[model samples]
Target chain A: MIKAEGLTKRFDDNLAVDGLTLNVERGEVFAFLGPNGAGKTTTVRLLAALIAPTDGRAWVNGYQIGEDNINVRRSVGILTEAPGLYERLDAVQNLTLFAKLCEVDDVAGQVEKYLRLLGLWERRAEPVGGFSKGMKQKLAIARALLHEPPLLFLDEPTAALDPEAARTVRDFIGEIKEAGRTIFLCTHNLDEADRLADRIGVIKQKLIQVDSPANLRHSLYGRRVVIHLASVTEPVRTAVSSLPFVEEMQQMDNALVISLDNPEEQNPILVERIVAAGGAIQFVNELRHSLEDIYFALIEEEDRETQA
Target chain B: MNGAKIGAIVEKEIADARKNRMIILSMALIPTLLVAMVLGTTFVMLNVESVDEASLDEDELSMIPAELSGLNPSHALLILLNDQFMFYFLLIPMMLPVYIAAYSIIGEKETKSLEPLLATPVSTSELLVAKSLAATIPAVVLTWLSFIVLIIGGYLIMPEPVFLAMIRPVWIVSMVLLSPLLALLSVFSGVIISSRMNDPRAAQQVTGIFVVPIIALSLVVLAGKIFLSVWMVFLAATIALAVDCVVLYFAVKLFQRETILTRWT
Candidate 1:
């Protein structure tokens, strides 16, 4: 639903977003990961047509950014980092205001639907100034979704909230993802992205990497299986290393950490070799890598490569 | 432009103004100060004896319009003072809307609402016009209502002849026609200044200078330097309309989505 080519934004001499080319498919939850000043918000603005890209172009929902700006804006929903609620206005009034501007046919129906879905129906009468940050953010999400646009761009929705409030927003995003809208989520919370994103794009003023969380781990570190054995025998290591299918092996205490090209296909052969060589078998499982581990490694590696 | 979207924004601004203490205080202060100034002068004109030709010079006295020249010298001065004070009504619409208009765009920056609002399909023209109308409606309405009170209060106190001076075509055109134009000019100017500025106080302080030209004109009238004929009123109205267009254009140009999104620090 969203596509960009060489999308760059330069604020005078300082480059905010540098040559970002990307594609987010329909119904895909694409997470954009970056640190502060990583051009994340600038990229969102460019894609949403809030600001024109300095050198490149993008299309959102078949409408080209900048050229077809109003249509592009009409086609997508963006939940800005700040909730941006009219604090003096009541929750219902706030949603109603955007609903009118968005030209929604059933303003009240859509307002009530999202408010109830986000668990904000009870407090709809209260002034938004009195709402908790989490409540205000949910109301903002509801405001963005009032017209039920097909694509969504959420820029740091859970940035400043406490863990509980952040979790609420994450779950709220989870529910939004399930609703079948293509979401382009920008988040500093790696865990939230890891859980919610169908694919992830890492950037530091440049498009560094884009892949699913699992694929990123696999590409960065080839598949490895950890075999737990009751006792470490010298022959067990020699036998596991002798297997022609084993790509690499390391012995850690009583476990054999073995690299495999196809663990499902090749693991039985390696296990057989270890058992035949007089090693008592325990169990076997694939080694899992956290997104944080992969993220830092990928970022550091990319940063080092760039510097080199 | 979408009338529904503009109407919604205007409606929202008015509702917020009603709830805002700053706007409410301004609403009360403007009309009260105006009524007090108008009534106080009307009372003075009621009691003063006619000025003899020997006291004030012919050149100074000649500034009164020929229509009022036949009245007592004091009545002529009353005509001048009342006309000059009509200039103050122009100041009312011009002055009242600036504060709110200054706040309209800049306040959006403060609350960080501009992005989301702009994220919608509302065009720049629609947003600027909505903001201008939001500040303009209340200000023009206040000036009109306060004009009514000035007319009624002056009628009760001043002589029939001087009271008649207050309702002449020049003052009527100045109030009903010119003042709304000046109000829009004030609002457009406010929106223009606010779009470039980071501080609402500074924007308002800068926009408050709009009163200076009106005040200068008022002083010139009071100094027996000029009399506003019907032609002059139309001329001034035309100029004010032109200036409003120019300022509105600059406001639209300066209020770029890129500048606003980047510079709203």
Candidate 2:
């Protein structure tokens, strides 16, 4: 639903978004991960046609970013980092105003649907000035979805919300994903992105890496499997290490961690050999790397590379 | 330009204005002050005979102008004061909208609401035009209403002949034509300033400088340096119309999405 090629935005001498190129497929939840000042918000603006790219080109829902700007703007929903709501106006009024701007067929009906969906129907009449941050953010999300655009660009979807409110927003995002909509999510919350994103794009000034969560872990640190042992004996350890698929092995406490290539296919062979060697197995699972691990490693690596 | 979007923006701005105590106070109090000034001047004109005419000579009365010299002292004073006070009507167009247009965009930026509003499909042209109308409509309406009160209050106290002369073509054109144009000038000028400045107070203070020219013209007229004729009113209207077009063009140009988002700070 969204494509960008060499998308660069330069404000005088400072480059905000530098040569970002990526394609997000339909019904895919693509999460963009980066450090502070990594051009996430600027990229969202360029894609949404809120601001034109300085040198490169981008397309949203089949319209070029700067060429058919109105169509592009109409085709996407954007929830900015700040809620950016009208505080003096009530919740319903804010949604209704955006609905009118987006040219929704039935403003009130569209507003009612999203407000109820985001659990804001009860406080629609109260002024937004007194609303909590999470309430305001939900209302902002509802405002973005009021017109029912096919693509959504959310910048830091859950920046400052409490845990419960963040979970509510995350669940709502999952619901949106289930409805077969394309979501371009920019978030600093690694756990939320790890759970919600179908594919994650780790970026800093450029596209560092893009892959599925599992694929990213595999590509970063090959295949690794963790096995819980009833008891570890020198014979079982020596036998497991002798297996050809076992490229490396380490014993931590009562568990054995072994690194292998293609563990999904070779794991049965390795487990059978361990069981045949009188090794009583209690638990066996793949050693999955969390997104936080990959995120910091990649960022630190990039910083070192930049300094070099 | 979608009328629905423009209308919605205008409607929201008007609603906000109604709820804003500072804006409401300025709108209400400015007109009341104008009314008080008008009425106080009218009462003094009506009671000019009670003052000592012996102390003041005919030269002071001759300052009223050769054409208006045929009238009695009270009548001449009413016509003189009425003609010079027409300049005060210019303040309405320039003053009221400054309070409003000064806060139009900068207020939203400060409140962090401009981003999402800009993210919508509404273009810059539609947004600026809607804001211009939002500031201009109320100002022109309140100005005309206050002018009507000033006129009627003058007529109630002054004699019939003086009232008839005061409500001539010049003041009519000034109110109907010149006032609205001046109000547009004020609004667009405020929009231009607010587009560049972050602080609403800074925008308003800079926009308040525009009133200097109108005040200067008022002072010149009061000093008997020149009398305002219908032709002069038309000339001022034509000049104001051209200036409004230029200022509005710059307002639209300077209010770029990137500039507003990135450079205003």
Candidate 3:
């Protein structure tokens, strides 16, 4: 649904978004993970056609970013980081205004429906200025979805929400994905990205590293195994280390943690070795690297490259 | 720009402005107070005339002008009110549009709603045009309404035939039409200034400087150094309207949504 090639944005002397190429498929939740000033927001603005890209090109739903900007905007919904809402207007009025701008038919009904869906129906009449941060965020989401656009650009949509509120937002995002809408979510929350993103892009400076979360995790750290043993003795440790497939082993209290060369080929043999050695195992598991680990590792790697 | 989108923008702005009760009340109340002050001073000056007619000098009589010849005390007071008070009174109304428009854009930025508005499907031209219209329309209406009230107050204080004739259609044209064109110029200028500056106070203070020209014009017109002819008023309006168009064009050109989001301090 979205394609970007060598997309770069420069502000005077500083390049905010570097030559980054990425793609997001229809019905996919793509998370843009970055720290502060990592060009995440800049990338979002570029896709939304709010600014012209200095280099490269992007297409959203087949509409070119700069050339068919208006059409692209018409086909996309954007929720900015700050929840840009008219505080004087109530939640319903805010959605109604956006609906009219989007040229939606039956704006009032759409506004009401979105308000109810976001659980903001009870406070629809109160001015948004008085709303809590989470409430304002929900209203912003409702505004973005008011016209049912096929593409959604969300920047920190659940940034300041309580856990429950954040979950509600995340679930709503899941529903959008289930409905086959394309989502490009810019966020700093690794957990949110881990839960919602089908593919994750880590951006630092102007460069972007795009990969599936699983692939990134594997690249950052090779697979390892966790063995919960009834007892960890010196003989078992030495024996496990003697196995050609075992690279390293560490004994904790009563458990043995082993780093395997290839868990699929080595785990069953290692289990037999443990049993043959008169060791009883209560549980055995593989440890997969998480998105957070990969994210930090990549960012640290980028920092080192710059320093070098 | 499509009319429907522009209409939507206009409706939203008007609704937002209405909800800002303090601003609306201030906009309404300032003009009323200005008119009251002008009329109140006129009444006081008229009533405080010298009790001794013999002590009145030829110079003071000349100050009253040949226009007051063969008129009663009340007629003389009416002539003085129009000749002296009307220009400054109109100055207040002219300044209102500048403040209203400047605040409209700058205030939105201060509140951080401008980015979301720019993110919408509505075109840049539509947003600027709608905001400009919303600010200018009320300014024009209020100026004309205040002018009517001024005329009524003048007539009530001093009933005179010449006073009725002095309420020329040309004078109404200058206040109602020309003033708003000038207001539009101020508003567009103010929007540009506000958009470029991050500090709302700085934006407001800088744009408030446009009122200097209006004040100067008021002084010149009131001092009789420049007789405001219909052609002159029309020329000024035309010039102002042209400047408004140019400023509006630049405002749209400089208003990059990405730039705003990135450069936000």
* Per-model DockQ: 0.77, 0.83, 0.71
* Per-candidate fnat, comma-separated: 0.79, 0.87, 0.79
Model 2, C-alpha of B54: deviation from truth (Å) = 4.8
Residues A1-308, model 2: lDDT tens digits:
88899999988888888788899999999999999888998899889888888888888999999999999989999999899887888998888889999999999899889888878889989989999988999999998898899999999989989998898899989999999999999999999999999999988878788899888888888878899998988988988999887889999998999999887788898889888999999999988888999998888888899899
Which 10-residue span in candidate 2 chain A carries the lowest summed lDDT?
A201-210
Which ranges in model 3 have alpha carbons more than 4 Å from their true place? A234-253, A260-266, B45-77, B198-204, B220-227, B242-246
Clash pairs for candidate 1: none
* Interface RMSD, one decimal, each candidate: 0.7, 0.8, 1.4
Q: Tens digit of lDDT per residue, candidate 1, span A1-308?
A: 98899999999999999999999999999999988899999999998899988898788999999899999998989999999888888889899989999999998999999999999999998889999988988899999999999999999999888889889989888888888999999998888899999999999999899999989989988899998999989898888888888889888988889988889889888887888999898989999888998889988988899889
Q: Pairing residues by index, what is the TM-score of model 2?
A: 0.96
**Candidate 3: residue B166 Cα off by (Å):** 4.3
Candidate 2 per-residue C-alpha lDDT over B164-190 given as tens digits, one digit per residue, 9 for 90 to 100:
776889888988999889989989888
**RMSD values, in order shown:** 2.2, 1.8, 2.8
DockQ ranking of the models: 2, 1, 3
Candidate number of the best DockQ: 2
**Model 2 Cα shift for residue A201 (angstroms):** 1.1
Error of 3 at A30 (Å): 1.0
Q: All models: lDDT? A: 0.87, 0.86, 0.78
Under CAPRI classification, how is model 2 graded? high
Tens-digit per-residue lDDT, A26-122, candidate 3:
8888999889988998898889988899999999999999898889888999998888788988887888888988889999899989888888999
Q: After superposition on all CA atoms, how large is the RMSD of candidate 2?
A: 1.8
Supply every candidate's count of residue pairs whose N, Cα or C atoms clash at under 3 angstroms: 0, 0, 1
